[model samples]
Target: MAKNQRRSVTVTLLYVFFIINQALTDGPRFVEPIPNVTVPLGRDANLPCVVENLGTYKVAWIHIDRQMILTIHRHVISRIPRFSVSHDNAKTWLLHVNNVHKEDRGYYMCQVNTNPMISQVGYLQVVVPPNIIDSLSTPSSVAVRENQNVSLTCKAEGFPTPKIMWRRGDSQEITVRKRKVAVYEGEHLNLTRISRTEMGVYLCIATNGVPPSVSKRVVVDVEFPPMIWVPNQLVGAPAGTDVSLDCHTEAHPKAISYWVRDNVMLLPTKKYGADLTENSYMAHMKLTVRNLQATDFGNYRCISKNSLGETEGSIRLYEIPMPTTISRPTEVRSQLHKENLAKRNVSKISQEERVKSKMMSSYDSDEINSHREIENRHESGNGYHTPSSPQLSGCISITRWTFPQFAAVILNCFFYHCRV
Candidate 1:
């Protein structure tokens, strides 16, 4: 009996020793392989650390130099808002620092713990301040046609919200004119929309409002100041007839209302009477081209421009009673017409009639061509053949030109119109 008891005790002792050896050799598993990181002076940063099979052992974070223990499991042991450490799903641990300061630049350590075993430690780093050496000065001046509204702006950038103030170049002292200048951002110093009268050498002051104010001088030039607006067409008339392209503009102290031909202005005269309207921005000059010839093909930008500045916009005009074969010209004439449009010297009423006639004619051509194309395709079996393959499992019919590319274009046009 004594010998049997001795054997049993020996076996039990061996089994316990084996288990202890395995536990000592195989410690907790490390999840993330990372080096200690260094961060900037004033920025946000995160340090990552993780351990697996972390069920029993608690985790700890300690700042080396500070000797301050930062975290214990999910509980952040630091009172400062700048310090926080959290373990998500018991997998990885993170330390987040906010709005870092220069003094905050230092090393941090991540430590893991388990019963009956030594702790594991990791490191982190932080860096601060940035290079500040660059020039900041620029505002381009431009000539604008008189009697038009203009907007000018100044832009600058820096660390720690740079102060931005605009001063008229003509003024000896940099004064903030309430209506003329207002700060878009107190920090970066951005100004939006200054009028032509506000154009001149202006100073941009960037200071934390501290001792030495850093100022970048900029000159804002208002360019080509012209005033133009959409014109209303003349009294009712039937569709599909001759049409005129009409536009109007005026300038301060009145500028010549002319059609911009390759950047030059054409005045209405004998062949075309000038349709003029007077306004503070418009020069009371309108153009009406009679007989509206193809030679007049191009854009007509109503230019109410003088020596001060010039500005213009485009109005689309289409051909009336267009030929069936040329229905889809691939490109619309309205935009292209702006580049080399004819501005004959003509009255407004006639110009209006001309435009009406052209539009009606184009619409009529579109309808007839669409009907004819459908009929022609239907008459030919090959042209109107429907896909019979199961791969194309959908119903298709005649009388409609449906294809992927055409469908995309239609969708795009629909969206564009919606936006407009």
Candidate 2:
């Protein structure tokens, strides 16, 4: 009976002690549900695990997908330097990741060892920003010719494949398929029938949900044949004066320009000067002529030649005569009258000589003398008087008189006179 009572008392006391201990002890219970976390690449991340009644129980962190232990209590088990453990008293445990990477993304579990292991899982998501891949993208500078087709490609890499867009560096709208598009969306950009206006810097932009969009610069060069223009095609300069001729041109690959005159190339000399200046694709050519002369009056051609082609513009030089004074009206009239009178007299003498030469063979000298006397009297009234001479009277009479009857009567008198 004593042994039974002792056994029964010890059992009762042991039961009471077990009940007391049970009332004092508590199993690990989560203070709140574990929440999912997100972090950007190259940043830090914290996975929190809060528990109550965690006395005498150790907290562990594990990578669930990798089936690897990361932290036990306050010590980190992973060899990776970025992995660590932190705690706030006995109720809170945190798994810290420094400089998070894409590989650190996935489920992480917080587990406690007890009668049966208790665990709560949370996910860590890492996002990577966009970045341009220079090696695969188009070159920084590209050269092509006008009216030719050109294509450019832009490449980028990111956690999520990046979207590429093309725009003008000046922020102007881009031209695609003859239509103006605010922004071109594609990895490849093609330009057709390119012209000098299309030559400039282009921008390739890459972006996604991540922050800090990236961009690259590409330059487009459009080459073409040389084209020449002259502001003044016909320039004039006076003798002994200085003159300048200007020629403007547009070309690619820098055309060789010069001045030529009368199929001969002109060089800079004391009398001639030439200069060339360049502004982008346009070139200004100037030719100066000093001490201009009559020989300088001609056509001058400004020639520009390049591998693509050649062109020329012409300027003409001319001589301007100096002004002269006019003569008085009276002097001009007197000179004109004298010239007219002399012509009339010469005509009369020539006609008279022709008649006399023919008639001299037939007519007698006495008859010719009487004819001359009558003509002298008629001519004396008209401001023309001839001196009389007996020997030359017949010849002079024939030249002065035109009537036959008067000449006959005069001939009778002359015959009588001759006989006497």
Candidate 3:
């Protein structure tokens, strides 16, 4: 019985030794291949290297591009502050790169210290957002004269080589080659023969496939001298009346505008007031002359001045006589013609007959009574008055009236009495 037990124990010992030898010869093996990693710039990245059956073996991480070892086992070997190493369950080794940069992009290898030195490589892609280079790009503000050529340039840097676009800051369309477009794509935006309409803020945008694109504002100022436009060169107003004269001007650099009369600058006062309204490059200037007198009538000028130059527009102010109750000869004739037209029926009376009949009817109503009251004192025995009489001696009765009305009455009477 003792001999049999000894043999059985020896067999058990051999089986145990065989198992230990097999475990030792197995070495380390990759459980899964390392997967490629993509991380944005300034972010952390974790590279996983899973292993199984590892016995007395150490895992390592290497930068294949630089041929530098980054980590070994649970300890970090790279001098870079962002490099770190960690493992879970002694099987999954993780290599950490914090705050990744463009220079950190390349191939990374997860290696195991084995008889044959097994390793697996993965690509670490670091993507960068767009960044504008101010020193090499257009300035924040640029000034150019009108009808001059100008160019705006933009420069950018990124991992994917950023694209550039130019557009107005006000969200308005840009004029390119005489064609209006909502957006322009190019590093350089050239404008030939620029005008005041193009003076405003412009946007320089740089973008790539990466998130958080960048942009800059460039102010394009168009400068020009003062130019005046006069709406009315001649203005007439009667005495004791108020009048307003206006002048429009366009200029850059914000021109100073004022009103001038006889080389004297007009100020704001009770008798005279001056006003100026401005809108960017355009200004509206007004001069109000209150209770105008004879002395206030003269040539007045609206003057505008800027750093570029000066310009002036003139207006002539003249006095008109005060109105009276008496109408002029032309006015009387116009009235007579209007009355004749009003008395016309749809049948349309003849012009001569209408004129004679209208004048007689008006005389009967407005002059007949006055003529009768004075007829006795001015009547002579021959039923006619002398030439000096106030009542005109004509076939039609005439009374106190303007010379035009009296002459028209006599002419119509002659035409009616002598009709063929």
Q: Which candidate is the best by TM-score?
A: 3
**lDDT of prediction 2:** 0.85
* lDDT for 19 (candidate 3): 99
lDDT of 1: 0.55
Model 3, C-alpha of 286: deviation from truth (Å): 1.4
RMSD of each: 34.0, 21.0, 16.7
lDDT of 2 by residue, 194-302 (tens): 8887888899999988898999999988899999989998877678888999999999878999999999999999999999999878999999999998889999999
What TM-score number comes out for model 1?
Answer: 0.27
What lDDT score is found at residue 47 in candidate 2?
90
Off by over 4 Å in 2: 1-25, 209-211, 262-275, 321-420
What lDDT tens digits, residue by residue, belong to model 1 across residues 1-420?
999999999999999999988776776777766466655556677877777766567777777777788788788888877888766786788878777765555566666676554444554444422222234234344444333434444444433445556565566432233333333333233333434454456555555433345655555454444666667433222234344556666444446556666676666664455666563333444555555555654555665567666677565554545445554454656655654444433456578678656654554465456557666777875465432322232222223444542443334334334221
TM for every model, in the order presented, reads 0.27, 0.66, 0.71
- The Cα error of candidate 1 at residue 202, in Å, is 18
Better of 1 and 2 by lDDT: 2
Better of 1 and 2 by TM-score: 2
